[model samples]
Target: MSTLTLEVVAIDDGVPGIRTLTLASPDRAVLPSFTPGSHIVIQCADGANAYSLTGETTSPREYVVSVLECPQGRGGSRWIHRDLTIGSVIVAHRPRSAFAPVLRASRHLLIAAGIGITPMVSHLRSARRWGRDVRLLYVHRKGRGAYVDEIATLTDSASFFTDRTAFVSELSLELASQPFGTHVYVCGPSQFIDDVVTAATALGWPPSRIHVEHFGGDLAPGDPFEVELSCSGDVFTVESGVSLLESLTARGHAIPNLCHQGVCGECRVPVRAGSVVHRDLYLSDDERRDSMMACVSRGSGRLELEL
Candidate 1:
């Protein structure tokens, strides 16, 4: 788990509640390459929170992430909004992927709302660079979209909506009319994602062709549980206040992980035996029967994990 020390080289508060920060190495070194829709976990004053990279993947010099001030959140967005300034340094993990663009699809149908458009910004950048077939449906308040002009400039097949009812009515037509092999992607609030997914499902879109990304939210502690590593025969107790990732890492288990809030699927472990209290947003119902995301998921009684 390597980390980069990044400096807030630039800040754009032009957008009302959204602040876009540009981070780069203090020495001007090139950053790691990332796929479209990738994100980096930044260390905030409260804890580590994942933000989607909005810059094109081709950029090697810096990473960009937009923060929407959340007074009701778990303090990460609040700290970024109120405390960070140009030249302020912070630590962050390298970019990791969970919601990458499906390059092989016949067409990409991107639907986003509010700050969910952050990841779609990168997706559209790559699609333009490669000349992929894509369409964007962005919904936001009349004057509050973070990258409205930029998105309109990037693609001609974009539609904007400020009215929820209008968007919902248009969504059905849009979902019903896409050509074959059009993979649908949705990113936004849980209810918004559910709406898109449900509409697509009703329209006969296959589950495999739909992708989703959930933003970091305050994680509530779960009941204490224990997990046993089958090979090592080591049992670790996960406290109510601590996550399994924290519990295991504290005991010297170097588990590969990203987005400890459980949106990214990097830290999933196979469940050999026992019942799992699946809490992650990444895994589907079928996948949950065999695996568990160690980041936010828990187990009841003694559980065996293929660690």
Candidate 2:
């Protein structure tokens, strides 16, 4: 993946603990065009965090990303909130999309859970620009959901439900009103995506129409596994409870990784030989047959990587 240098122009608090970062690129050159549900990975002082593109194409050079202060895990969010300042130069990747809007559908139903609102925010903008009918259902824990007012101002009809039961009922009605071709985009935690998929599948929505994006919190670093680097012809033993990427980096091997949570697919490597116990959420079953996400996945016993 190609890396671009960006300068922080401004950072503002959109809601409590959530800040929107405005980045400025050189030459007044425009960034890449991204679909409604696209997200860009930004490298912060500590680590990397993936944020959905909230800025419009007309303002391409000024990329907007919202960060929610995390109390646990890596320092990606907290550093952005506390340490990031104007004139700070950071490395980032251009917009890459996984949960793009389904163009074939005339009507759309967007579901966002908690911080999952990031990607859905861009979808609303794209849908509105194209004049596609859209509705947003935002579900959040009590006192945790942020930016409800901002979302309501931009969407056609926006509703919030703190209670899971009420939220599911309203979501079911929305799901029922639309026909089979309607597109459903789900974003949030693993449980949120799992629940939405289960409910949508039960409601007769095709599996192909439901797209999901995970916002961190995935597999626990598994037991140390063995990896045979095909290119260098060397075997490395990853320590227990350490990610394969970390193990490789600790041994002075150069490899790339972004969202270690398995969503970004930046650290994916091909398997040359041996079996791998795949754990990433991005890859489908068929894709896992020959590849593995080194960031969050581990080998079954010993595996060979094309590296």
Candidate 3:
């Protein structure tokens, strides 16, 4: 991906623990055009972090992204919250999207949890411009979500849920009430995304009509496992707390990787043998049959890789 040096034009506290950063070309030139649901990989103090673009895409002059400060995270969010400031120059990759809306759909159903509202905000704007019917359901802890007030001003079709029970009940009804040719877009934590998609599918929504974007991997540690390299016949133990990418790298395996969040497909490796417990969204069903993303995925017992 190509990189661009941009300056932080503005920063604002959207909600508790959420900060919105507006970026633009230092020369005040028109930035590259990006569609709704697109995200850019920003180079942070620790590493590159992918964030969805939440600003206007039509004749765009700037890109806006919201970051939820995670105290226990891998340091990217902490860096953004503490070190990044207005006028600070940063390098970011060009915008890319794997979670865009289906423009041809008759109606759009947007469901977001917490900071996941970032992409939905972009989708709402684009839907208004395209004159497409759209409804938004935003779920977050009371007074804890980002962009609540800004999103509230966008559409009257929006509904906010603070209670998990109420949210699930309402979500089921909403999924059941939508008409034919309606597409659903969901973004949030892994469990939330799974719940939404699973409920939609159980209600007969086709996989093609349900789009999802996972914010990040489940940070909870997993069971320990082993991985064997096919090329070198070397074996390495992947601890319960370490990622496969980190494990391989620690053992002198040079692997090409970009975002450690599993959104980018840069760390994909062929699984020559053994079962893989896939945890990434980058691979398709067919791709999962032969390969897995090393950054977030792991093996059940032992995995043989082409490396």
Candidate 4:
């Protein structure tokens, strides 16, 4: 991915734990345009972190992103909240979209929780401009909604829920009322996504009509395992607290990688033989049969790779 050195133009608190930042070119150049659900990888002091763009898509001059301070996280969010400031220059990759609206759908349903509401902002804006039928269900803590007021202006069909039971009840009703050809987009914690998907499927929503994006959580290291390269005939033992990608790279193996959180499919390699514990959201069933994302996926005892 190409990098752009942009300056933070503005910063404001979206909620107690979330802060919204506006970034622009230093020389006032028109920045690259992005569609709804697009995200850019920001190079932070600790590591690269991806944030969804939540600004105007048409004739965009700046990219707006919201970051939630994760004190217990991998230090990326903490750096953003504590060190990054207005007028500070930061490097970021060009915007890319893995989750986007299906324009052919008759209607749209957006579900978000906590920081996941970032992308919904962009989706709601575009939906309003196109006059598409859209509804938003924003679930957050009582006072932790990031952009509740701004989102309210985009659509009157929006609803907020704080309790888990109430959220599920409303979600079931919402899914049941939607007509055919309605696309559902969900982004949030793992449990939240799983619950929403389970309810949607039980309500007769097909997997094809359901879209999802994971706001990744910290990946705890798995048990130690050994990996053997098929061609090179070299074996390496991956420690219990280390990732397969990190272990390989430390041993001088050049593995292509980005978004180490497994959202981006940059470090996927062919698995000749192994029982892989797949953790990535990028790969499909067919792909998982032979390949694995080296950055996050791990093996049980031994893994033979074609790389």
Candidate 5:
């Protein structure tokens, strides 16, 4: 639960509606090191928002993250866009990684779309540093791509597309032709990830070889459910519009959490009974069997938790 006080050393409006923040320590200390595809959760004005680290991972003095203003999001990116500026200080958690490089894979195939390119940049940075075999298939809207220029300097094996249909057709061919040890890493909307995973599975790609980066998404207002604390036998009714974590906190129970979006695995609790509608990106299917992330996941029936 440690935190870092970061000073906004610089801000860039180079991309429309996207602000790139360069953060450094006030006393010029070297920041905590992170691996490729790592993200740090920033305490925003509204709530904590997680952004992928797109800066150097080795002995870096500053950390960089690009925030795209999400109109339909839960107001964290809106706060970063409107209120933050140079010389402003913000609090952030140290980098936590869930999407990391597969060191044993023979080759890395990275796929990204729109703001999903944020995490891929960190992946490419690591591939360049250690001479790892890597390729990127980036799909972005016309003239709205982020880090295209930067990614060009890293690897010439990248492919860019503006047409979704063309990209999917090409991706199907690529997925089928990769070598035996090739692994695919993808980041985008939940549906997009599902489509990519489906296509890969159809192409005989093993589940172990397809990695996904699941981050922010608007949670659906699931059916109302109730959870009982196994410790105290106190039950809390989770309403349609409210999350289980929100309900617990509103009832004066403080749960340690970082990303309200379920990308971080901080608020996961052991499930003692009932079924879980797995919505979090941080948990594996095996891990989801007996545990649930209270941030964005919902349950059915009288869910019992070891909370």
Candidate 6:
């Protein structure tokens, strides 16, 4: 995959922990176009952390991404907040989409929990432009704690600032009453996503119609495992200290991997042998049956994958 090493032209504080970084375009032609809910891997002081593009990627002029400073985890978002500055050069991979909004659905029910609002904000914007009916249910601890203003702009948007109980009840009722063509997107903390998924499933919503995206929190990294590539006939021994993307890149095998945390799903490959320990927030059961994301996930044992 082609990458653009663009300079950070401008940076602005969007909210308390969020900042918007405007990247200078590398090329003067039509920029890489991405749909709503698309993300690009930005190389920062702390490796690569994927950020969803807030604005539309229409021209070759600029790109905007809102980064919520993460104090914990691996310091990726914190590095962007503290270290990244105007005129600082950073390698940015072309836009990738693992959480794109499903356009086939006539109606969309967007549920965002805290920082997860970033991707859904973009989806809401695109949906509004297309004249599609969208209802945003933003769940937050307090009205001031979340990106409430951003969510308020969308049509039929509701907020639950008190607790999860009220949010789940309202979400269940809203989803149950909606037509069958409605698509539901839930993104936030792992537990929150799980709760929303469980509730929606209990309401008889199709699992395929529910999409989710997770960023951080006690995501226990799995043990390193060995992998054998079927096409290249190459074997790789991923050490415990490194990820599969890093391990493969250290060797001669250049697998296109961006956002090493597995959110972008760029390094997904067909699984031919052995069981894989899936770690990504995306990917359905059908996708897991044939493929595995090589970045975050590791093999249970010796595995064979299509290179």
Best by lDDT: 5
Return the lDDT, model 5, position 211: 84
Candidate 4: which stretches are off by over 4 Å? 218-259, 263-266, 270-292, 297-305
Q: Which residues of candidate 5, in runs, are more than 4 Å off?
A: 218-259, 263-266, 272-290, 298-304
Of the two candidates 1 and 3, the one with more favorable TM-score, higher being better, is 3
Worst 10 residues of 1 by lDDT: 214-223
What digit string (tens of lDDT, one per residue) describes model 6 on residues 65-86? 8877768667778888988889
1-307: candidate 1 lDDT, tens digit per residue = 4789999999999989999999999998889989998888888886678899988687489899999999998788899999999999999888887788887899999999999999999999989999999999989988888888898888999989999999998999999999999999899876788789889999899988998886676444667888889989998788886888788788887888866777557888899999987656567678888898888888888788888
TM-score of each: 0.80, 0.77, 0.84, 0.83, 0.84, 0.76
**Model 5 residue 206 lDDT?**
92
Relative to the true structure, candidate 4 reaches a TM of 0.83
lDDT per residue (tens digit) for residues 102-162 in model 3: 8789999999998899999989888877788999998999888777777777777899989
List candidate 6 segments past 4 Å from native.
26-30, 143-147, 160-162, 216-259, 263-270, 273-289, 298-307
* Candidate 4: residue pairs that collide: none
Q: For model 4, how does the per-residue alpha-carbon lDDT over 121-217 read when each residue is reduced to its tens digit?
A: 9999999999999999988999998888998898999999899788888888998999889999999886778789899999889988988887755
The lDDT for every candidate, in the order shown, is 0.86, 0.78, 0.86, 0.86, 0.88, 0.75
Instruction: Score residue 198 of candidate 4 by CA lDDT.
Output: 93
How well does model 1 score by local distance difference test?
0.86
Candidate 2, residues 133-206, lDDT tens digits: the string is 88889998877776677687787488998999999899888887886577888887767777888888997888
lDDT score of residue 55 within candidate 2: 76
Say which prediction, candidate 2 or candidate 5, comes out ahead on TM-score. 5
Q: Which model, 1 or 5, shows the larger lDDT?
A: 5
In candidate 5, residue 298 scores what lDDT? 91
The ten-residue window of minimal lDDT in model 2 covers 214-223
Better-scoring candidate (lDDT), 4 or 6: 4
